[model samples]
Target: MTELDLQEYSHSLLLEVQADAEAEGTTTPEAFTRRVLEDLEQAGVVANTFTAYHKTHGHEVHGYGVSDSGDTLDLFITDFHLNPLDSKLGKADTETRFRRLLTFVRRCGEGFGQEVGESFDAYDMCAAVGKSLTEVNRIRLFLLSNRVGTWTDVSANELDGIPVTHEVWDLARLHRHATSGVLGEPIVVSFDPPLPCVSAPSNEPDHSVVLAVIPGRVLAELYAEYDTRLLELNVRSFLQVRGGVNKGIRQTALEHPGKFLAYNNGITATASQVEFLKDADGQPTHISRVHGIQVVNGGQTTASLHYVMFRDRKDLSQVSVQMKLTEVSPDQLTEIVPKISRYSNTQNRVTLVDFSSNHEYHVRFQQITRSLWAPAKDGSGKETHWFYERARGQYTDGLANARTPAQQRRFRDLNPTSQKFSKSDLAKYVHSWHQLPYWVSRGAQKNFNEFMARIDEAQPRVDVLYCQRVIAMAILFKAVDRIAASHGAGSHKSMVTTYTVARLTLATEKRVDLDRIWREQAVSTTLEDAIDDLCPRVMHVVTHPRDGAHVGEWAKKAACWDAVSRVRWAVPPTLEAELLDHPLDEVVAADDEASSAARGEVTLVSPEEWYAIERWAKETRNLEPWQRQLAYSVGRKLELGQGVPDTQVAQALHVRNEAHRLGFRLAS
Candidate 1:
């Protein structure tokens, strides 16, 4: 890390800062200022660059730092200014003003150069500059207003240095332990006021859309705030503590037997367990893998669609057609994708056969005449298909399942063959859970009941999602607040609305391409208001990992922003040395297999509890005086052997015949 030191340009700026009181001097200085400007021009400066002209001998108003955001600016012609309120140097005589301005400009350039040389280490200096960097942005602003030189040919690596900062490191640290740690992580999002449900027109058939897992807080905030107001309702969080959880960590850990021991193990990472952040382009960008939370392998460890996208087949004559596959989750692909077509314009069909099944796919390809398409929000939006389709698949259970003679008669009436079946008939062809025709059965009730059940199990994720959303809102609010404080934006609401709309419209996934339409006609305030209104209804099924962490960073930017917020963090010190020696796999094996973090099981102890345990172990001596070598149990400290040895606390409860305390039902 390079230390901060003022450079030559900084000195020039400093001189201008000094010129606030300095009277303009001789015309000789103006000549000097003009020559410097000429050299800067040769270097390709885009902004108002302060140049020293030995001939004219003074600084002059070059360009102003131009921001397209339309924020008001008060400018100075003679001196450098950090703010608009600084005094102007134009009051002095023309020749004198020009001369002093030239002197100040020279000073700024020399000072900036000095600082660059002294303050930065080779690594801290970027190989190149990029728009993402705050320093580059500062340069951009200076060029717009001052007689700044353009960037001639800085390499890409130099540009990258512009954005690097300690703050970036701070924000990145949270994502390391996302999935399993106290740090928010590997989020399972199920949107409430479901995205497409609200956006879908009444007439359109709803299709599931994919929410691809993105790695950064940027995308995380985008998803959370896209419709935040709608998300807050009935939202919950998953961070409740264990028994006597309110007690400090040590006390709580002591009550829940062995929990702390497991924690000590989990935090100790081996070479394979850690994940680090990548750049926006998904290339590794961190110093090392410190902590990590991985995406769960819940659905039988299937690979991501991204990892193995189906492309070319062996048969060239199959007539390939490009098609977009969005929501291709294993469940949806397994259960519903047999009905989906590979292409809407071509005669090729694709079937998602079970990964374990050996069944052959039967595909039918068809062509249709072009028809008028519907609009997005209109009630007459779409009556049948949501998007285009080309082919279909048929998979039937055994025909032998039908009664012999009656099956033939029913088959004759229904006819085994039709060029194309209607939606209702297609539904009938698919078996129903009740053994009736699927469409006729109106599985709506069944589907709704299943949805409710899922809600019951997945609610913790939703709570986490809500907290995440709150964090995103707070961060965006802070960024906007800072930006607006610089601008004249009247209130927090107005500033947020403008930026929010811009951010959402850019980041959100829409059924119809909003960006395409937005280019033709800018977003309406009504749409912005609609989005704001929708925020409370947008709920996710997990804790807020992204948004919460980001907001914390934002609030940390200033002491006033930080307020009195305190975050409690922990690491298993005992496991720390272990992490250095063993692999993560070994550590995980040693921790608790307690799947339910909700269960009470903290059996670790603090020094105070350790004292109590040793004292109790001394008192609770085992039988046989000669058998002093017998083990002493720290039962009282564990507080576990309770209630017939049931629940997690049972083993430590010390009841001799705990098995008799509970019973199992006998077979009838």
Candidate 2:
């Protein structure tokens, strides 16, 4: 927010990157580049198939990501400096880096895989990009730097008639994004000829509502340009259910374009700001531009429209669809936007699980980490916290919130950046331990979504014991990760580590004493030895894909897991002796105490506060119809000064909790 804050953030980020390199046993430059790519993937700035490859001659490329449809390719090049905080990437250097990345793309399009031997790490990526060139309509070249950059404008060029755009994610830009509450870069849509719209009457000042009929052609074009960035808030991916709504929408768009408005549910969108064109009476009549526009609902409809217009080459000139656009202030974007998305899609059976970050499970898990302290390790008497970053920038925010140098130092000592883990990291650890190695091998974001879905189904209680088990899982994962790095697993290290853990779990029958691990804060040496023994065997199975398939892609398949599972590497006798006699219980009797304490805390909220929460939920539409009725009943009972039963109180508390999670705030 200020110059001093920026400086502190920059220094902290560089230190974190260096710490990652040390933990992963890689050079700082490689780690810095990989970290940047990982962040970009998590932020939805790039697709998930990003692989790191650093090879330079007359051209260079650090990493590459290919879209699922094969229509978009992203290439990255890094420019690292020793003194990143003080260094700056000038315009000329930026242009040169972009050119190098473009040259690599050009070569890949021209079948450079032949020159790059099949044995090389990058050969598969090169060959794939070369083969997919015909389908690739756009290529984005990124220059990743830890230094500040003087270049601001993104230059667009073409290679072999395919549009190639250049972007630079320098230190300052990366810092701004990290601190900002929004996801990825904002999509600012400017209409060449403003569309006429009618503003809905609204009593709220934080947001305004508008109703309009948008041209189907315009929607398709916008999708083509922005793609999934337009649907960032929409958790649902475009599912092609046969003969379902998607197919019907496509058919209607092609056969009855003029009737789309009458048949479809249209789209619900949000914007942080909007420009209006008013008539002589000063009444808003048209929308000229919108900032931070995101489609929260009707993703299927939007994607179907894109498919019909672009893939099918259908005329959408006669197609018009209704749209409800909510212009929310920047301050309310994080809080209100998710509620808008969740409520708008409730008719489709979307639950709070779809918004996993805000789910009660994660919220409780975050609270546990904050309150629980880990045992002191390495003979130090000081205990530290393993910080679980439930949301992005929280760990940094913790540091930035400290008012003085002494407070900052104390914060760092307690919650070291090295001890920090994200939701994706937790997903990878838990999924690996559960013997879903293939899913873990998939990139972080995808694996995290799958893990959340499983969590929804299982509905495990988030108590002290559960939190300890999660930490034990984290400890086990990091131990295996370090062992894998030591064994020269190289690019296949992640697959090797996950498979090793999964195989061990299967062999030992999930009998590891996670409670022991949590108390001791370290894995037993015998167990580490067993992991060491399994690493090379797992590596062999993962790296040697059947039919010479790409190892990375193959690692994501069930067959790979099956092959690794079939390996005859047994847990060593010593480690087997250390395994627990029985599997850990799904629930502990002690957790009931914790649950009762939680409920007691909930009941501590005064009746007046509950009434206020009900009113807020009503005004904000934060609760479901059923939940709203319950809230009203609770309010009525409180108003009548009648004692409410514990069951009714708990239900009311649940409603209030859900509303709070969705950003409902009672008047102070």
Candidate 3:
């Protein structure tokens, strides 16, 4: 293998180091900045980042990236006090910090050629300024501070004819965003008193629609305040499809601001829930807060208002747009929100399937998961079930919340917490399996949209068995990922692993005989062991490109996938045998027999304990599949051995303590 100097650590690894350092009461600048970048990546703020840490010219700029449309995305970051809680920055101090960010934005506007050399790699901001690195469309100035200052003047405007917007990820916002996935934080929007609005309740208990007239300026302000975090996936994708602001909106706002509301269809939005403030008479006067606000329709209108009012500097005092806000429960959010978005935006040429969860593929997968039962294991006495959560929060609040304790137990017996995977996760796996690893690395929402776009184009209908096989493929992908991680290929940790695994599958597809492995429509131990054996070699090729070049950021880009697809490598004799030989063949009869024996053995400890562990794993702990399997295996051993052997007792106690740490309740 060729040696490439991986001297500069990735942002993910740097964050890991930062966490370890903080635990020991020490911190480094490299670690802190990288941690901030990692936080931004996790929150879906930015996809891929390249550090341009030029000693002289990297002051106003930290790094750069390419937008989905191939525009240069300049990143200006300021690392404020590592501990915001300990910072005593006053109002003036905070304003000064924000002003510095504005100055940096101005610097980017000055021109990239001026700050650094004409050659792209001279500044290391981009590879080819003359070729692919065209113009800078967005300048994201991230103020990594512990304090949230009252800075509202950072409005959406233009710099040297290019539209500019900024977002401040302060400590409070960062902490809230970091925990939001686990705690389900509400999107709070506090409005003035006497906020005139009308609420219409639906037959569904937790769903409703609220109608209100909001000034175009107000909407622009919110868009400016929240940035992309405000828009849902459907709306966000629509806005991208429409490009920048539509000329029609600007003309209406500029010429007839008073009649703009009458001529326009306004906007349709959705929220998880809405909170209201009441007057002395107990009538709802103002909408106090809204959870998960997303524009379902009139994305063009919403974007136009923001552009016309903010960028065009047009008056919008009389340009009030009607907003129809549909409030759905969290459990129903994923299923209903996209439907609302698609149904409302009929004026656009957007594909309905891309905005639908009821597509034939998803429906077919749901049927397959619900009908087929996994055999019982670890003496549970009941067959296990797999619940394919097509919608967000379906596994927890949607299905599990309505079931009785015993019913939930049976569900857990069939589908352990580890076997649980979401629709978005499935999309990544399916795409990776097809050798589209770059798309898989684009995060869940983007990847889901990408997958659906392909589905809408190809209309490749799948059967129940095919759906089951896809799930089996996902499990095998995860097992291989663990093996790679164990081998210290820490760079494969991100969604990028989807591409690596895809490359591996594509390279080895001819030899592996995937059709034979899929005959049973489940992940068998023989298949798992085969994947485990191949992962190290797969990861090695992925980490070290055969051309004696470091496959660094290239792996995250589409070019890497294209390059890997054209390369060929040698496979070991044993791996070749495992791939080529069928399980029923005499040469592989021993493995087939072992698999048959495993089918009858109990894999779970106790049904009651398994249920509790599964619940804890999904809701409280959010443990990985391997972690859940370990806990289940330990629990089973404890039950079978009655905590007799000292080693067994120690292992059992260790897992029991971990369960307690994850907030799992103990038996009385």
Candidate 4:
């Protein structure tokens, strides 16, 4: 065969392989789609969870992802035996397949939060992310297949309701994106007639400051188009500081629309490129598409505009807000982006820890990891050290310069499993292990910032022991993750994926005698065996939800941990020998003994409220048990003033209202 023909034939063979694999097990396509969708993360898509089901309401959804921004994606991975557009196929067959896809989109849209799918409870999934049909700004239907084709029928691109958009990710497209390292196009915000703007040159010619009066309606439209992608990390936190409409911005917009520019500080935005539509005399007419749009400041104003217009359903045609657009060249993005984020966000301040990577915690972790050595398994006297990567590319750079065999061995000693653990990974594993999956699910950067804040409040100074504990927790998490993957592939391949394994880890951690486990300074073989035993129970808890609770929400919060921790599992007989003579046994035993007396006082939720809560939960049929449980926990915290100040009263009230809507009752 000719080279081109050979290439085409090889493509056909690969598609056949994918089709065969998918048909053999339900997880094949789910896993494949997950690997493919992970690429979207580079494009700024922060997905919290993935769901895979054999069938969702009599339709095979294959898999889907729920983003942190409350957007839902319906994934369909098609691995057909024959190409639908083959010459042997009749026109009728093609039409039928196309119409079937349209039906799938409609079905997915209609069944948004329903639990008819094989994945986790959709209702619980939506509730955990605070998403509802009304709140879901967009529903993306992604059709992925090995066979290449375009949807020439433009009419079938979107569903009528819920702002649904369709996309096709064929094998060719996936290959290009994966190989080229190119991101999807940045958002383009255009202003017709080129709204008048003034420009000031910066230090670099490629970078300039353009001041323009953007229509409030246009800004809201831009927000709707980009969602959370537009907000810088710090800006997202600032907007989330309080709930409900900004009374000041609202009053000004509602009462005096004309004074919006004068009253507001306006939004500060960054873009990779900006163009102006100009007249013959070179006077600017309006803005063309502003590429790579990001809001470094004025996230409140941007979000407030969307909320006021879409949520409040208010008119914004008469309102116009000011915008300072910083056009940045691609080459200077790395250095300039952080600076823009820092200076533009003066009103809603962020700290050095939030933006910079040169924090003391990272330096301390590097020291701890380098100083500590892993236990020698074979009694060789030689031990491996865990290389805690404080910065990106540090490991690779070190390995590249290794000249001697000892140096090479040193490089290898930094175990690969633990090598990639960054501060973000530390935040994720620690929070998820400690029963804070909700924060972990909020995207890595957001979770890292929160974890840093917690560290600041709880332990202003880092110590060796605390760093050791963090490292130990990460090791355990990694061990569990590997075991889960092995089990999924070998035993329960159809029912498990990495994401499910994470959820299962959270459940298993509840059953784990943390008091006992923590005593062992390291993740030893005995703890691994214990985790293996706990996996079955974790799977049971995940697949079966007691009391009709929202399992997803329960799993995300500490309430589930509080419930599961009450149960104590005896040591598995098979691992008793290993546990008895474990190297760290004495230390662990000492810690456990010291903490045993105070265990009862360590409850996160007050035991005093149990009777009243149980009665209230039993009486309230409107709310899911999980909702009741969550509300009670929040209520208890409110009573205890658990870090919540009077300033957070409005947000607290909003939480209460959400709980009530979900069927939690108000106290008389």
| Top lDDT model | 2
Backbone steric clashes in candidate 1, count: 108
The TM-score leader among the candidates is 2
Better of 1 and 4 by lDDT: 4
What's every prediction's RMSD, in angstroms? Answer: 29.2, 11.1, 19.0, 10.0
Residues 167-285, candidate 2: write the lDDT tens digits: 89988888888887655889999876888899888899899999988899988888777776777777555544232467789999999998999999999999988999999998889
Q: Each model's C-alpha lDDT?
A: 0.23, 0.78, 0.53, 0.53
Off by over 4 Å in 1: 1-560, 564-668
Q: TM-score each candidate.
A: 0.17, 0.84, 0.50, 0.63
Candidate 3, residue 655: CA error in Å?
50
Tell me how candidate 3 scores on lDDT.
Answer: 0.53
- Identify the superior model by TM-score, candidate 1 or candidate 4: 4
Pairs in steric clash, model 3: 84-146, 377-602, 377-603, 378-602, 378-603, 378-604, 379-602, 384-414, 385-414
Residue 517 lDDT (model 3): 46
lDDT (C-alpha) at residue 201 in model 2: 88
List the candidates ranked by TM-score, beginning with the highest: 2, 4, 3, 1
Compared with the true structure, the alpha-carbon lDDT of candidate 1 equals 0.23
Q: Identify the runs in model 2 with alpha carbons over 4 angstroms from their true place.
A: 240-243, 346-355, 585-668
Instruction: Give the least accurate 10-residue stretch of model 2, judged by summed lDDT.
Output: 346-355
